[model samples]
Target: MEEGKPISNIDDELRQILAEFMVEVIKLEELVEVGRKFLVRFQQALEFLRRPSIYESSDLVKSIAKANETKRVNAYVQAGCLNAYDSTLSVGQLNTSLSDLHDCVTKSKSIIDELKNLMDKAGNALCMTSDDQLETEIQASEAIGSEKLDGVGCASYMAVIYSMVKQDYVMQEKIVSSLSFKSSSGELESYCLMWSLRPFINDDIIRQALKQVR
Candidate 1:
């Protein structure tokens, strides 16, 4: 920003609001779709396992548990929060659900932070492309930056059933195969693949998956 030039013009301010609003709308719609996935997954888990989570010795757990135990998972504790993973099933499953929720939360934070950086370019008399164009670009930029929350949350949630709590070979494979859980880009690819698969993942599951994400 120039010393004499203003930090932002009225147009820039309006465009920023519009851009963020559009992003929120797209996010909400995607969330509604993703929410369904959790329901389906939880139901499947309920039917298959006949249990929510397998008991494990907290002593044998990884360092993540020690760290995570301190930070409260924020999504399911609220009223009317129908987390697919947070069903009244098992304590073990709840942990996995929390992880799933956290995965989406982390991805959302990344995208929102990226948007903040992108918005930084819009400062000081920045001329925004029309809303249509801006929307497309924002989505494009989001895809480039995000694209993983959907998959990671879903895949990892299932993994919790096997890898985290249950250690059930059959269910673990089922979860992996169900989601085709390959993530070439590690975390980044994880979020994208999940996002791409959001429509098919079930609504409740999607919502639970997105619990941790902002």
Candidate 2:
């Protein structure tokens, strides 16, 4: 009976640890969803900023600028408009969109920070050897293996995805911050292309991650 009791206690402790690990996995999934939402918001703002015609002719942009007179005055002066009302109007719309994009990027930074902390906790919980090293080793093929990932493998996979996403977000923030009325068409085109390409983020890995969650 004594031996049986010890075995039972060990089993219970193992179960408890597994439960905690599962809880962290669920939390990670939830945070990933939230990060997805923020990414969409930031993408929308970037798309709007990319297309001058869309914002320039947008009644919504006009309404937003009209609601904020200070922004209108600042845009007109900073854009270096002389007497062309149409040019001033376009510049005002651009400024408003840039401001919105900046806000989205700022919000995304907070989400990324939260995700980084969560990934660290998850890695520690899984007793991973080294989060930094694992991040580089774990690839889409490994993440999408036929067998289910062990605790350490799962945590490492998530860390890799998080690192890529964080890098992509940093790149996006830099691009958005660099945009201005003085930016040439070529620069704007390059910015749009880079955003669309998303060089840092691997689509296959993200798809595999989603599959794991499902």
Candidate 3:
């Protein structure tokens, strides 16, 4: 996660998954379509998991007990909002289902965070490209230095670059296949980093980063 950023955005791995859908200049409609599909799929999966998560018990209790114990001791533990877990558990108070709901809500919230991040990226892509005065505003707001370009402008450029890549059928399929559970989070982080760079870095630099990842 970015410093001071509370939610998990797309990590590199998920960005790579997104790259397959990108082109040098992706249409806004296409971006929205892809995002909608992902959102729907995530919602479906969450729904599928929700029932078992609320109705089932044995395993969830053990996990939550261990997790809470870990959180209690480790001040630095990176975790989701306690309120999400707390509210779900509070409703079921005396029941084991409380733990189950906690686990389910936690996971679902993370997925929702990703969806929010995706929408941000899509919005960034549009704002950076369509707005004429955005650069001036950004330039005026920040000190005139290297860091000036490292904000939304940079992320916008990265989004454009990903869209520009001429898709290779075989390579794209392979890239998608490589994203197993073990590497998914990392890929998401990578995608986020690549696209989240300062806009001044230019296309060649972003392309090189993509090449190395490939």
Give the number of the best model, judged by lDDT.
Answer: 2
Shift in Å, residue 181, candidate 1: 18
Q: Please tell me which model should have the higher TM-score, number 2 or number 3.
A: 2
lDDT of 2 by residue, 35-121 (tens): 344434444444444454533566885576567669665565445423356545655666666676677677667767766666666
**CA lDDT of 23 in candidate 2?**
48
Model 1 weakest 10-residue run by lDDT = 160-169
lDDT of 3 by residue, 1-214 (tens): 3356422242333344334323322342233234334423333333332333331344665466557776553332232223356445533432333233334334434443453355346445333444333334433323333332333444443444433332221222233334332444445444334333422334554543344334
Measured by TM-score, the strongest candidate is 2
Better of 1 and 2 by TM-score: 2
What is candidate 1's lDDT per residue for 33-117, written digit by digit as tens? 4433543443344343432222232343334444455434233222222344544444355345435644544444454444444
lDDT of 2 at 17: 39
**Model 3, stretches more than 4 Å misplaced?**
1-29, 32-163, 167-174, 195-214
Write the number of the candidate with greater TM-score, choosing between 1 and 3: 1
- Backbone clashes in model 1: 25
User: Where is the poorest 10-residue window by lDDT in model 3?
Assistant: 165-174
At residue 143, candidate 2 shows an lDDT of: 47
My TM-score estimates for the predictions, one after another, are: 0.25, 0.59, 0.20
